[model samples]
Target: MPLALYLLAVAVFAMGTSEFMLAGLLPDIAAALDVSLGTAGLLTSAFAAGMVVGAPLMAALSRRWPARTCLLGFVLLFAGAHVVGALTASFAVLLITRITAALANAGFLAVALTVAATLVPTDRKGRAVAVLLSGTTVAMIAGVPAGAALGVLLGWRAPFWAIALLCLPAAVGVTKVVPNPAGDGPGQGRRPSLRSEFAQLTNPGLVLTMLVGALVNGASFATITYVAPVVISTAGMGELWVPIVLLLFGFGSFIGVAVAGRLSDRHPEAVIGVGGPLLLLGWVAMASVATEPAALVLSVFVQGALSFGVGSTLIARVLYQAAGAPTMGGSYATAALNIGAAGGPAIAAASLGAHAGALGPVWASSLLTAVAMVIALPSLRVIAPGAGEATR
Candidate 1:
């Protein structure tokens, strides 16, 4: 890999850290801001909601500028947002900062995937995008653990500060290494209205692929927020060991992503079909581990691996479905992933509040997998893989 590739990866790592670290620090933030944990969670909601709004908006406006500058600007916005998040005295001001940072966060990642595809040879595009996106896995498996530790040991403000620290180096790295052409990227000018971009999105196959992405992501995140609690409570583990088990889960998650990326390029639907069920089984197993600590750890491992691994296939599938209009498909996938992250938790929260146990998320996860399985069936009846370049 080129050294410059690492630069893009750095930006992703920083962005992923910014997105995931907040969950760990929510209580501290809530306490400091004189708000409830539920209220502090609005920070995550605000970020997701902002992505739904900001992704296409940024994609549209930034097309007139060079891709490098746009990415750098978004990083700067991300950094400044975190700075305000760390320093602001008032909850309202902090909320505003999060929204701003988060909007930039979504826009940055949306373009980053497209940019990554351009950075390398066409043959390596699959893995290249995977490597860049792998930062999310790293941030979740590694950054979150450290950030959460920092937040708990130092204070809630400490994690965002740590994020900003990481961001400074990453911002400089991306600026130094990522190429800045004098004009827009290849084929950029032809991009029509966001409506035109989305018009292609209505294709039955593409919509189904996106639904697979959304439902899987939503179920994963929704249940994930409570995984540690489930492990400790249901598995009857010592409280001190929660982080260790969570670390194991994270390790499985990132490794899954790396493997799935390579696999998706070969057999997209096969990858998802296998991955989705593994994840469903993982969830079911996780729910049933009320008496077996050993079983809980095993479930977490499988959960991390399969849930995120399937994502590579899911994303690649959407891009393929969009045919010639990849940018729109990419942006749509970004939005769908965000929606899933939000939707799954919302469902889990509402249901878990009722009489259900961990089974609530487990069954919900299973239902989603079933839906994705049905919807993600073969779309190319006449033309399959390696049938020559797709003409749509």
Candidate 2:
């Protein structure tokens, strides 16, 4: 709700848009750059791998700088990557640029979250991170669809150029608006030892929590990477309408993300418990789409809704696991998120492309989503019967 948060959100929206638009435009990008679709898919891999590598490394190193300066520098780096990516002609060049941008994005995302939490009261931590993160979800709703549309109209590179333009002022806005919350510099405060980071992570609850996050993300990407093509080939939709359908999928997510924080206050586990079923039903429905457009649309919407529905619970879930060590716990969650981001695409690609067998990506995602939910149930039970605020 703070203007500072909103500015950070703006930068997040642009970064997220650039990050995800590749999924919707994979075929176009491959053709433009003279590469295989699978090879182009590695574009996502490059970015995710960078995030996994950058999140903790940057978060740890930036401990010495004011959070405001760190954010501003990252945003400039963010904008610069897009500009470079937009201009590159060789495949290797584009790949390098994407990695650089993601490195910047990874640092910005983790640090902004750490800084934002300092701006709000403890009771509001979940809501604060949730709102800040929802900017990424909002991009899924509006930005990805819009970027896909632009790609269809202006070539795949155009969206990168647009992201560069969008990020330019967002960098300025963050420097001008976000308040500097005090941060314990590197090697200051009660810094968690390597032993502490390792020990806390070994806890079963936190481990399962992250595993579920990885599986869910893998489920979503494996199916979504091919969604546009599926609609075009299987559902007989027009090329012009692909992004519109994608938008419908994300519109459902946009609504779910907006409500998730408020719902967490009253019913966290109950909602988390139901996510797997919705994903299963969504795939079942998507399978029947050739004969049922309405059902297909509904399925995609439901998939978006429940996929994100459970996603909202992630930060709080981490807080619960950390128990007494909020800062360490928070860092663990961010790191897990990046780890998932890194691993999901490789797993999804293997499942969808080579071993997909008869049922294909939709069924694969559905099966995995169910597994994620089953695994998450026991982890959710670890939360104090009361809200997490006491220990969180």
Candidate 3:
């Protein structure tokens, strides 16, 4: 609700765009760099690896720094990395840039989550997080598509420049709007030591909650990583229809996140329990209808809504369970989410490599969602009692 939160969302938009736009640019990059498509794809994996490693490492190292300072520094660093990436001719240099940018992005997100919680009351934390994550949905709807268009029309390097430029305004806004005093959490500026903060990892509830987050997100990326190809080959759609289907999914995700923000605070159980099973059903339906244009299109929207709704709710649950660690709590969520981002697509790729049909990713998504539900629904009692009720 605060201006700071919106500014944080804007910053996240640039980061999300950089992260997701590559799926559409890999071919151009591969050709330009004189490498195989598989090697160019490693750029994406590098970013995820940086996110997973940098989340906790950067969060812990920057714990003593002012929150606003950390955010500003990371934003500038990310923008600078993009500039270097755009100028580079060597694939190795571009790879380093992706890693550097992802580290900055990860650190920024970790601090931003903690800062968002401190900006609002305990009851509104879920909504605050939703507002922050909506940036990603918007990126899916507009940024990735636009980046692809730019790459096609202006060259693959154009989107990199655009991403760098996009961050400038967000960097300026972060300097102006985000309060400098909110370093990590409230109090006399007392900072917890690494030993004490890392101790939160020992909590079974928090660990399970993180695992739930990873599994749910893995399910999401599993399908989404392959959605474009599925839409083209399976649904018999033209290139124009690819972005249309993706736009529908993104719009559905926006609506889903809005609902999650409203309900997750008090009724996390309902949000996850109902949404998780429905998401699994959506994936099953998606696989069955993959060859049907109308049915597949409709299923994508429903799948997006259900997948993000449950995934966002699980993030709120992880943050709550890791509340004792404040800044590190965001790192926990970030690592879990990125772990899924990396692993899910790898699984889907393997399935496709095994000569599974165009629908392989959909079935992979279903299995992952089922695994997530099996892990999550039964342990809701231990991992996520309603916020309004007592925690076990």
Candidate 4:
């Protein structure tokens, strides 16, 4: 809606790209660094770990600073980490750099959500958040693939260099476009106490909303983390086609977010009431028809769609329920999502390790989504009926 929101989206795009591009570059990184694939993959784990811790910590630390200043500072830190990552030859150095970048990315995203909500009308907070998160969908559709191609053409480090370059303009844009709103200035009212921030979690509605967000995200990533292998072994597709299928998933995610943005404004609960079941069904469909190429393609698309479709509403719900602690709300949402991102894959991997077939992840993800739906059903009654429309 506002230019500042768009600039926030740009910052998100750069951060999202960094977060996912590593998935496509793991093989190259493993080989280049003379490490096992599993070790290189830990880089992703490190990043997720950083995000799980950094979001609330940064939010607490920056409580007295202007949102614009926190955003700019975090982006600069992220960019500097990317530069270090790009130059590092040792795997240990790269791992540390990725963690640092993730911490900055987490802080940037948490602040961006709060800032985006502030920039819009109460009725439009969902759409505003959707606009900000669309950057991640766009990154999935374009940035990851492009970074993979860049890695293929040059080296795994090239993508980091590109990410570093991308952050420069985002940092400048935030400084120039985003406002330092009243009450966010330095020496404003007393900083939010740790006890007060944690009190937000005492709200059953907010807590349930966070759990649902985590479960939904965990289910999605459970399948996505191992999609290439699942497609190849189960669908009988060649390796080259994996990227195309992933592209379809990304495209579906983009559409899902666009639609969710509108629906969340009108019927936020429906995101879970309807979209959650759809997500579970999508996963079940994939598990049932994993060997059929057509079915696999359709299932992936549907899974991606429903996985993301409910995301905007989840954020809106948290914002509504935790209105008094908006910054903490944003941070908590980010942390919950990252927790799922990390946990989902671990569960999927364990299922596979237990001799489950290529469809193991599909089954695992379905169970998680079903749990999310069960959680969502009761939580809807806990949130104030009109809370979605109330601005704190």
Best by TM-score: 3
- lDDT digits (tens) for residues 199-318 of candidate 4: 988888888888888888898889888898788998899999898888888888888888998878667767768787878888888898889999899888877788888865786666
Q: For each candidate, how many residue pairs have backbone atoms clashing (under 3 Å)?
A: 1, 0, 0, 0
Winner of 3 and 4 under TM-score: 3
* Best of the two (2, 3) by lDDT: 3
Q: What would the per-residue lDDT of candidate 1 be over residues 261-343, giving only the tens digit for each residue?
A: 78665555466766777777777677767458888777777877888888665765666666555455556667777878778
Backbone clash tally (model 4): 0
The parts of candidate 4 lying over 4 Å away from their true place are 185-192, 383-392
Show model 1 residue runs off by greater than 4 Å: 181-195, 378-392
- lDDT for model 1 comes to 0.72
The lDDT-based order of candidates, best leading, equals: 3, 4, 1, 2
Give the candidate number with the greatest lDDT: 3
Clashing residue pairs found in predicted model 1: 218-340
Score candidate 3 by TM-score against the native. 0.96
Residue 366, candidate 4: Cα error in Å is 0.4
Residue 327, model 2: lDDT of: 39
Which scores greater on lDDT, model 1 or model 2?
Answer: 1
> How far is 100's C-alpha from truth in model 1 (Å)?
0.7
lDDT, candidate 3, 1-392, per-residue tens: 89999999999999999999998999999999999999999999999899999999989888877888889999999999999999999999999999999999999999888888778887877888899999888898889999999999999999999999999999999999988763343211566767988999999999998998898899899888888779998889988888899889998888899899999888888888888889988899999888899998899898888888988888878788887887688888888888888899889887786566777888898999899889888898876687765232
lDDT of 2 by residue, 312-332 (tens): 566556655654342345455
Q: List TM-scores for all candidates, in order.
A: 0.91, 0.86, 0.96, 0.96
